[model samples]
Target: MSHAPVLLAEAMTALALQPGALYVDATFGGGGYSRAMLAAGARVLAFDRDPDAIARGAVLSAEFPDRFQLIESRFSEMDRFVNEPLTGAVFDLGVSSFQFDEGARGFSFQADADLDMRMEKSGPSAAEAVNKLSEAALADLIWGYGEDDASRRIARVLVQERAHHAITRTGQLAELVERAVGGRKGARTHPATKTFQALRMLVNDELGELARGLSAAERALSPEGRLVVVSFHSLEDRLVKNFITERADARGRGSRYAPDLPPERAPSFRLEHKRATAPSDQETAGNPRARSASLRWAVRTDAPAWGELEAPALAPKAEAEWKKLI
Candidate 1:
């Protein structure tokens, strides 16, 4: 199936694309954003951590050799490759349609596969996390990353099940979570959805990547350059919201969580839209996945870049344990 870029029109409008201007598609999942940017006559440099995404982009790169390039790396490292200040950059965050639909990739419970959720197909995988991490760490991961209230119960089940045999498959883990959660009757989504999401995010260091990528975008964009992001869940949306609001604040009072820090920095961005833009009902009807997506954007200012964003370490225990395994 062809991958549909969520909020395509909204994101394109946010970019305000200008012909010949260099723009970065920081998450070139299906090259949808890159293709659109190129169509608008922009010079596009796209980045993707997943090797599959890079392989899929070869045709687009070949078609526009002079105008388009696809880099197989994380968006957080974009600053290293982007020599010139950018005209615009867009991030379609979270799992791409291609990743979710391709059952063999192990991104979804729709089809059974290995418990591997590595975006770059490297480092430790979800299976290692499921079978090796302690019960307390698993609970922390699910509660912190997944935000599921039944995280402790789910974690206990994982520990118990894995003792008999390793949780090495997507189907196995999903079933375990479903049983742990008691099926959560009337739930629109699957019982294991959040569990799967948490594991995938951990395996990819997703929130950490986003925090770094936003900072990279801030450093790389020219004055008035657009930085657009589409995030799928509360955690991502909250981080994006805070990043923009904090930078756009003229007071520069630092974060409320860190009140002791000096408020000496100037505003680095202009937040034109205070609220995030969501897909229209019409769009959601066609693509159910668009239901949770939220789009937020900001225009870069002339002020000096701010300090590097620290990825929120929500579950220290889980993270510490997972680090040992990797």
Candidate 2:
């Protein structure tokens, strides 16, 4: 599956890019958004943690040497990379189709490949976490990240199975999960899907990165600049939604614990729209991965800059339990 930027038009429109305005594509998966920004006459500074993404960007960099910049780093470090305040920034969250389709990347369960689900292909592979983590820790990771209800039972089965034979392949882990979960019934998706998702999130610290990336984006944009984010999963969408809502409403009068922080004194971003925008039926039909995507955007206001917002704390007990499994 080649990477096609999801909601390209919607994201660009939300950004309201101005001619020659500096912009950032925080998740430059395939450089789809970066190319679009350049076409729209905006100067782009893009970041992608994946080396493949960076290498692929070479063509675009050469084509628009003066207008485009590609940085091989996570979006969490966006603030450190940009010297000037940005006119806008876009974040297309979740694993890319390119990553999933490439058999060697180990991002997909459909392909029987090595258990290496690293987004950047540098971090700990899924195989390491699955085979090394303790049962309790594995359960916590599956439940917390994947939202799998039967994580404990699945983890137990994994431990038992791996003890006899180390699980080093995607197919092996998927099979173990299916057997433990009693297999997917007719019309149901694969039973191992959630477990794979959970493991990927943990291995990459995705949620943590999103939290920090949002804050960095908010801090880095110039007043009136837009911050657009497109999320494919509820976990990612929920964080994006809450972050905007909280910041937009943070200044209002309330309890002592939440005293009225004036709007002018609040961070510069103002929620641009009320609800998230979803992909059209046409888009979903063309790209199944776009089916779950939800886009949200906000405009930076002239308010005073605020301190960095803290990333949400993961459930400690669940986190600790998952840590033990690893």
Candidate 3:
């Protein structure tokens, strides 16, 4: 089943579509945005790392063969795939409903399935991280990535429990976390939410991919072309916000060190609006997931693209601790 695109109206309006121009749908989850782009008479290049999404996207490519192409790859690789200047690029980031709903994929705490969270279905699974990794490393990851304050306690419990049996299933892992933090009574959210989120982020290396995708978008967009991104979490939102602010340094706003910021390079983009855009109340009523989603967009400038981007490290201390397991 296909999932409805979040912030649909905001994304489409921000794109300001132009017929016969090239456009990129960077996430291509359910092909909702790609279908809309083709409907607006634009040629679309869609990317999805998930093989299942690419299979689903095949129908759209066939429907508009001349105007659509679907690449079974990550958005970070867009530059390697497409060299053409684009009229617009749209990124719908984070876990897709298709992945979340499929119990076999095991992304949700509510589901009883194998503890697997690989978006591409290849590489180290969450089971490995949970069953392996030091308690300190696990805790650091939870705190840094998931923003869970009780990460140390949760990690300590996971290590103690897994000594008897391998934490191979989502339900097993969830129960361990719940017992550690007290059962979910009068709790605003599930105790395992943060743990699951941290594991997912680490498994996917999502933050690194986001940084690369933003750089690729900056390189590929044409002058006056728009770049629209919709992110579901605060961490994702902060990255997008920083990317735009750094690239669209219109009027001397650089970073926290703006006043002491080094001499400027040629700004490659301009923000259409500074504030983060949110889904309409009506959209949120029908889709609660849209409640936390935030959209940020900018237009490409005539200036040349920046060289390479130096992405932030995912906590050196955590990485050091995790390296012992892998």
lDDT per model, in order? 0.93, 0.85, 0.87
lDDT of 2 at 143: 83
**What TM-score, computed on C-alpha atoms, does each candidate reach?**
0.95, 0.92, 0.94
| Model 1, residue 164: C-alpha shift (Å) | 0.6
lDDT of 1 by residue, 1-326 (tens): 77888999999999999999999999999999999999999999999999999999999988999999999999999999999869999999999988898888898989999988889999988999998999999999999999999999999999999889999999988899999999859998999999999999999999999999999999999999999999999999999999999898834444777656555578899988888999999999999889999999999999999969998898899999988887
Distance (Å) between predicted and true CA of 157, model 1? 0.5
In terms of TM-score, how similar is model 3 to the real structure? 0.94
Query: Residue 254 CA error for candidate 2 (Å)?
Result: 10
Determine which window of 10 residues in candidate 3 has minimal summed lDDT.
250-259
The candidate with the higher lDDT, 2 or 3, is 3
Model 2 segments more than 4 A misplaced: 250-267, 315-326
Q: Report the Cα lDDT for candidate 2.
A: 0.85
The model with the greatest TM-score is 1
Best by lDDT: 1
By lDDT: ranked, best first = 1, 3, 2
Native-to-model Cα distance after best TM-score fit, residue 187 in candidate 2, in Å: 3.9
Better of 1 and 3 by TM-score: 1
